[model samples]
Target: MPRNQWKPFQSITVQWISLLLVCLVALPVANASEPKATDIVVRAKSKDAKFIGSSMGGAMVRIRDAESGEILAEGLTEGSTGNTDLIMQQPHRRHQSIAEGAAAFRTSLMLSEPVFVTVEVLAPYIKKQARVAAQTQVWLVPGKHLDGEGLVVEIPGLVVDVLSPQTHRYTQMADAPFPIRANVVMMCGCPISEGGLWDGSQMEVAALVKKDGRDFATIPLALEDVNTFGGELQPDGPGLYQLLVYAYDPRTGNTGVDQVSFIVR
Candidate 1:
């Protein structure tokens, strides 16, 4: 074959391949990436459980595949780093520009289809490595970002010291619900009424009951005052109980966890 005759054929083949590549790149995440799914995002918010306030930072979040237990993504909710999550940035540019979750966390992951996802959050309330923690499972749809249910964690640097009944190894009436009280401020530095990014009223407070150093149950405590909450432990029978008072500000993703020990006799 003459050189000129072969040139046209070669040019056509190259052009066809270039178009094919562009098409592939333009395809949705599912068809473009392996497993044939879309990219999704997970977000977090912190609220004060003790003072009904909010914290500015100090939260560690983890997203995992419920079935495989694979860690999909993880990050801190410290407001220092702007939330770079595609979900938070998506649907519009203004939303990303003015988004106010300084203590919030956002993580992106890819999936092929709809599946269950588990989100684990740890918020250090007292800087003692003890954290206000919460876990929830959410159904994530392909190509969609899912906002996890709010997780209540302890506010860093805040402690809800149990006041009513001194925490001790002594036993209480097993059949009776023991009274509980604590003094706490959920805000990171200032009071909730300061009227700034760190507010307390937006936080949710929940109580956790653990058995032998393991979580056994949760009781949501009611705020009595600015920084006080009242709740009770009604043990079924005589046993050791570890009660953790927790605060989480979903707005900033800050958390606080406090605990006292008691015995049921």
Candidate 2:
């Protein structure tokens, strides 16, 4: 994740408290070289939102008019020194400006030989979720048509350690009239090695519910005795139900939630 575009998720409750959500941030970055004279550089390293560093190795930075797509500001490095930095004349005011400059730079490549320029975007926050599924196999009737016994839910955009095994398996007892069992598997991007570092120690699941294309409910769920982050719903006897999984990041107090649907007989 680009530094500027990266952010921890935080939860918020609406006035109705029907659905839960988190903030989303977007950031954008670069390409390679051509004529030293026409080339521009957008720095990737920084502490603040704006690009506030000196340019090195004859590199230059340019800020263009957002609407007209005209060059409004420019900064160029003085020599071949690799460590040198070139600060932009005017700091980028918003994400749109960076996007505009990126577009202009890309356009330049088609007209003339490609001049490699790097562009980056900074935003507020991003959201991510953990994956969920039945840990064990539940009994399914042959052709008698009983409700499906297994449930699987996946969360997208999650970061995992990637070095160790990334599979999780567990089982949950079905509640009430359903009278069966559920197995869940959580596949996280973070590998097993990284799992111990997490505050939750284990990833849990939750549902992001919607109805008729509008937000409706967010339910925390769990398996067996473990509070995986969701609750079981009583079946209406038949039809489809949306199931989701969520991961809580204790470090940033952020939560990621995603969903799928299931049918009950």
Candidate 3:
């Protein structure tokens, strides 16, 4: 072949080699950007108690992208509240697995890179008035497994439900003393009782009364049974009476309230 013909062939050969090199160099980078399945476990824990689980109607969990507001995973925790001794009685040490058999919401996220995510939990799903929401933010690294105790969000506050002097009740003034009753429990649905794990005796339960929107009186409730508190309200004169019943634990600073209104004829 002539030298000019040979030059054209050389240029074509070099172009082909350049293209091949570019593809080879880009392969690893493209693979690195591919999404990875990352496992995560999330648990909703009642403050000073155990996990919020099936007995309490489980807890709803939502994992979302912190910046984008996109939801990554959504579900409810399943299983038990956890072992009473392990979660409450035993003293926790560093790296202790308190959630070995506890309830959890487990899911895998497809992540190409690290993500800042927000984990939100709404607990005791069945109890609308007593339900509480808690959330936390964390950076999730691709391929990292958040197992073991995983991400635990503590939920504080008690669950208070007014059981007597029901909402919109019409009472006769002849029934001078109106009976008041309430049920109080931990956020995990743990029973509160005198001399029990969660002692009702240590908590103060009361009913704050208001007549026609005016401050009436405060009546202290005594523990009547497990998780139950009862008292009587002696109305001075019958009108529209509102009752706000509350339970407070001085030691743990856990408190909850429930209210009801009734008309006396």
Candidates 2 and 3 compared by TM-score, better number:
3
Stretches off by above 4 angstroms in model 3 are: 1-13
Q: Which candidate is the best by TM-score?
A: 3
Tens-place lDDT digits, model 3, residues 128-177: 88888999999998898897799999989999999999999998989978
Cα lDDT, model 3, residue 223: 98
CA lDDT scores, all candidates in order: 0.58, 0.29, 0.93
TM-score of each: 0.39, 0.28, 0.93
Error of 3 at 131 (Å): 1.9
Comparing 1 and 3 by TM-score, which wins?
Answer: 3
lDDT of 2 at 180: 19
Worst 10 residues of 2 by lDDT: 160-169
Give me the runs in candidate 1 sitting further than 4 Å from their true place. 1-57, 80-101, 147-158, 161-183, 187-265
Cα RMSD, model 3: 1.8
